[model samples]
Target: MKDELLIKFLLKETNAREDSEVTEWLAAGAANQRYFSQMELIWNVSKQLAVTSTVDEDAAWNKFKENAGQLDVQRPRVRMFPGKFLKAAAALLLALGAWSAYILLRPGYTTIESAATVRTEILPDGSEITLNKNASLSYQTRFSGNRRNIKLNKGEVFFKVAPDRKKPFVIASGNTTVTVVGTSFNVKYRNDQTEVIVETGIVKVRNGDNEVLLHAGERALAGKGINLAAQKNPDQLYQFYRSRVFIAHNTPLSRIVEVLNENYDARIRVADPEKAALEITTTLNDENLDHILEILALTLKLTVVKEGDEIILK
Candidate 1:
């Protein structure tokens, strides 16, 4: 009975048992001594303006506004005032303190916009990102206090995260969870499997029961099932994230098609696995997809047809 009450009070979230625990804890003369002492500390901290607003990146100020468009400006959706007394015990509050995170810092879950074929961008917290092709990434603006989390369901992006001894950046896509304190790396999770390439950073990839750490120039491959692939790199795996390539040398046809679709919105499908598995060893210089496709057809000697956004190859 005492344990559950303590937990809820700590979290500041309430339930029926709360009243019972308070009565019991207070009824015991010695227990009241501890409880009131702790409450005094909490109220004192709340009274200090500096301590109340002193959320320094690590505390994760996840206070949301009603419309939730802006934080700290006062809105109906805002969960509750830090100044308000949350009816939680020390332990529960301490546990929730870990969850004290900020949203994407921007109004709406942050929207990463780019019009260049290749561009480098930075987040509100000084994290660097490189966008390739026509990729759009969106995340929360209030990312500091409660959750330093971002969701990616498509495209390829490389990140060079700053060291915040306090908060960590979390990237979630499908079942792939990439957690980092301070690291530089790249990820391409547009397809079935998440392809992560770390350039110079300490990154941990969690997929199901597997938790692998990438030191530098390492690659971790994750997918739908249990067979997770973790490969080390001398230099080859990170070659793409190393320089950012719009083209590949002797790249498989399947990979090429996927790249074109994501990069230029050119949907090309190789109906034959025999043809899709074929490797193309040529440079795709500044030419458009049509020009590149024409060159491939002539060189590979394969039948090609484009219908709407679909390209069928036999």
Candidate 2:
């Protein structure tokens, strides 16, 4: 394969796990490091080209025409104008146009998620994130390196950051910047306030004007400036999240069903009079839809099925 194709494959497959190998490869020798540096420069310049820049619908077509005319002259040589190269360039341009149209027509997508519970998100680095109830998070596909980047729209997020020391794990919400080498942490930034409490290892929370190093068992609240103090309850530091069990302890049936549905990915409702009247208490410790439904069935004596991920109860 060509050098460009190798780099493209690596770029597409880039993730936190690959970071270690890349770092090691970079440090293998000065030549390898130089190659990476050049590639990064190219990547940076390519991104700034803004092939998918958004503009008014009428203005966009005019701009595209102008942009196309401004392109450099293409050589007739097959090597310079290969069939594969033309196809790839055409595909890339089409994708860019589609992206611009999507941004122009759908303004709501300009919004990140809001007030979500147990949101499973895939990051640009292929790392998965799960935001808990009343949680919110957002991100831009384009971001600076040196870390995985995310903007917490609102609410809280539990991060299982893929390990990438070169690019530190960073969460920005309000004025707080939760920075970690490579670890798990929960950040809650709703309303105008921000809360960050680390679970494992350590994370540093820095506000717009304040950057303070925070250790494990440390929580930070950022508003106006970063206010970080040692966690008052160090013993049960992360009990609420660590339990991972959606326990509707004496909670109303209607509310409990909603919580269960949101958390365990179930769509169960009180189907019968007996089930509705029964105020059952159960724990869902990382239970899937089927497992949770089965437990609920045993608890409430209801029927469940294996209709893919969806749980339809009666």
- On lDDT, the candidate that comes out on top is 1
Off by over 4 Å in 2: 1-116, 142-144, 232-242, 246-314
Q: What is the C-alpha RMSD of each candidate to the true structure, in Å?
A: 14.3, 15.0
User: In candidate 2, residue 41 scores what lDDT?
Assistant: 51
Error of 1 at 117 (Å): 7.1
lDDT of 2 by residue, 1-314 (tens): 12343244345644565556566776777655554554455344435544543434334434434443322222234443334433433343354664442232221212346354456676766666776766666664533334456778876577777777777767778766787767777777767787777667778887776766656667667787435555532333233444665665554455555656645546566656565656666655666656766776787677865456555555
Best by TM-score: 1
Query: What is the TM-score of each predicted model, taking all chains together?
Result: 0.56, 0.42
Give per-residue CA lDDT, model 1, range 89-206, as digits (tens).
Answer: 2222343343231121223466675555766788878888887665577765646343467776576788888787667888887898999988888887766678788878788899
Q: Over 4 Å off in model 1, which ranges?
A: 1-109, 113-119, 132-148, 164-167, 190-193, 215-217, 232-245
For model 2, what is the error of residue 236's alpha carbon versus the real structure, in angstroms, after optimal superposition? 4.0
